[model samples]
Target: MAKPKFLIKTWGCQMNVLDSDKLAGTLMDLGYEPTPSEDEAEVILLNTCSVREGPENKVFTELGRLRPLKKNKLKVLGVVGCVAQQEKAAIFSRAPYVDLVMGPRSIMHLPELLEQARHQKALEAEFRDDSVLYPGGKISRSHPVKAFVTVMEGCSKKCAYCIVPFTRGREIYRPLESILSETREAVDSGFTEIELLGQNVNCWKDGATKGFADLLEAVSGVEGVKRLRFTTSHPRHFPLEAALLMAERPNICHYLHLPLQSGSTKILKAMRRQYDKEWYLDLVRQIRSRVPDIALSTDVIVGFPGETEEDFLETLEVVREAEYDAIFSFRYSPRPGTPAAKAEPVAGEVARERHQRLLDAQLPIQTRRLKAFAGRTIEVLVEGRSKRGTEWMGRSGDNKVVNFTSTGQPSVNTYLQVTVERAGANSLFGKAVTAKNEAPGAKCKA
Candidate 1:
């Protein structure tokens, strides 16, 4: 008989992608082969995100499309991740065909849930006190060169407009030993780049003795780790030591995603971000003082409840001052049950206008910053072929996407020096110069 097949359609951040990998790994362990085709699978899991209203709506639309499949086939249809946790039994009411509704924290009980789903509806949305660590498993990693290791899960920061805490529960830090062990395993499995993942990554701590900076130093010391990175750090939790470590460590990537939700101090307070504009800028200054060439990216929300015209302009002012290489900007959409959801909302048209203005202000700044790389050579980790296919795609240590042409076909996952020929706001274009050797002006730690 042919082996059973499973398909996991994932939506959301890096954390969600990693969750899908764990779910796939679990199913693979249970004798199920992963299939890309929805028609060929015996099990289908929708690993979801409820970070924003848009993604949440997309999940429901996807479920509607899967309704015919669920009705026609004997497939075990499941909804898992943040949306599952948020909706609970409501998912069953919305899409009665779904067989399982499991949350991010409840992933460990997947085997039992799968068994129970075979006969009747299965639900597991309870949050666990302990960390959800996948110690040993064959994870179906999305990227061949890079591996994402979760150092922590969930967010403790209760930002007013955010829904993360409700969906993912409170903070749960993974043990230091478990993190190092996983990093070693990933390196042994030929992954050169390891990205530490979490809801608020820099907030990660191991008991009272160790913190995120310590974790960075430890992971950088791992023998085969060529590059190390972490993401979605909260400004309040980001330590100066982490920035200093990035400057000193050869393997640590010089990239930081410090979110500036609203550049206006008043708006930030309204959002309960904990740090004001002056404080955030001071932190940025400190990081830059240590690593001057480090590339910085940020998340910005244009319009929030009670945001004034002056508040929007303040955000634009901060954007100019910060000089972010890239900005992930969004218009605020209130999630139900959040404090902001009960408050008066900004008009849709006003929000849209502010969002456009914010993007307009950032575009030239981003372009100018990226253009600085031209005529300089940088170290790039070759990821794979680019969408154009004529050039290869890779990323710089600062997390800039570098697409370069090589004289000869360079193998993926190898480090190469690329002389940047030109740059756009979105990416850098270049040609590979040498293999596995440092070039002058390379934006990497000594």
Candidate 2:
């Protein structure tokens, strides 16, 4: 028989993207080949997220649409990730056509679960063990130059509005040696950029020997790795030592994406963010003081329970002060079982109004930041060609998207020096200067 063909759809953050990769690897180990189109696949997996009701509804709707495919012939359908962790029974009850429903921590059991699904009428496998690590390489990355290495799983912080802690469980960081080994292996496989992924990456503390800083140090020492980056750091976990590490490592990108959910002390305290507006400002100041020219990004939630115009303005104030390179903005949505879910709801009209106000305040700030890069020569890791073909695209060390046209096709994964000529609200357009092999710039202060 032919190897089982599979198609996986992922929704959510980088952590979920890494999970989809691991699930693909698991399927590959079970003698499956990935199919580009879902209609042809024998096994269809929906890796989900529960951060918002919109994503949850999308997953449910997709599963309902896929029901006919399972009915006509032998096929397996699996739902994994945050939504599965949060609504296991409800998902099964509402969509009994689903053949398998597994949580984020239980996805490693997919091979075994698929076996059971073969004989059982319906398979509902939701195990609550978060410590298990799937052996590496069930599926290779689609990107030859970029690879995601998950250094930690789950979350310990039960933020009032987040279901991460309840869904993915407490933060359980991967062993430091395992992370280092995996990074080296990915480098050997021709990936030049390695992104360390975690819900709270900076909070990593696996054993007596390893913390997030130490993990970065180890990974930086690995050969063949050109760029190192991480994501979704809770402001509470920002340490002076970690800041120093970024400053000192040449390979580590000089971009920080610390989420500042709300700038008001009242909303922050209610959200259980642990850090105040002043504290976050101090952290930003420290990073800038240590490494000037370092780009910064953040996440902001505009309307929380009991949030007022003043509370929303405090957020705008922080944005103005920090002058972030980019921001991922959100309006609060009640999540079941989160502490904030029980609090009084913000009116939809009011929330939408606040969201638009915050966004309007950000666009010009982002535009100004990009304009500053104009006329500067910076090194970019080219990913691929843009849709128009007149431009090749890549990201700068600070994670700004840069695109430029070249006379010849420049190979992807290689760094190119581009002189920025024009700037847009989101991306930079430029002309390729030269392809040089020297180290781009000195290590920033740690």
TM-score of every prediction relative to native? 0.96, 0.95
Error of 2 at 152 (Å): 1.0
lDDT of 2 by residue, 122-184 (tens): 587766554335555544565545778877778888789999888888877788777777877
- The reply for model 2, stretches above 4 Å from the true place, is 128-132, 387-389, 435-446
- Candidate 1, residue 322: the lDDT equals 90
Q: What TM-score does structure 2 among the candidates reach?
A: 0.95
Candidate 1: how many backbone clashes? 0
Candidate whose TM-score is highest: 1
Task: State each model's CA lDDT, in order.
Answer: 0.86, 0.82
Segments in model 1 whose C-alpha atoms lie over 4 Å from true places: 435-446
Question: Global CA lDDT of candidate 1, please?
Answer: 0.86
Q: For model 2, how big is the CA root-mean-square deviation? A: 3.7
Error of 2 at 434 (Å): 2.7
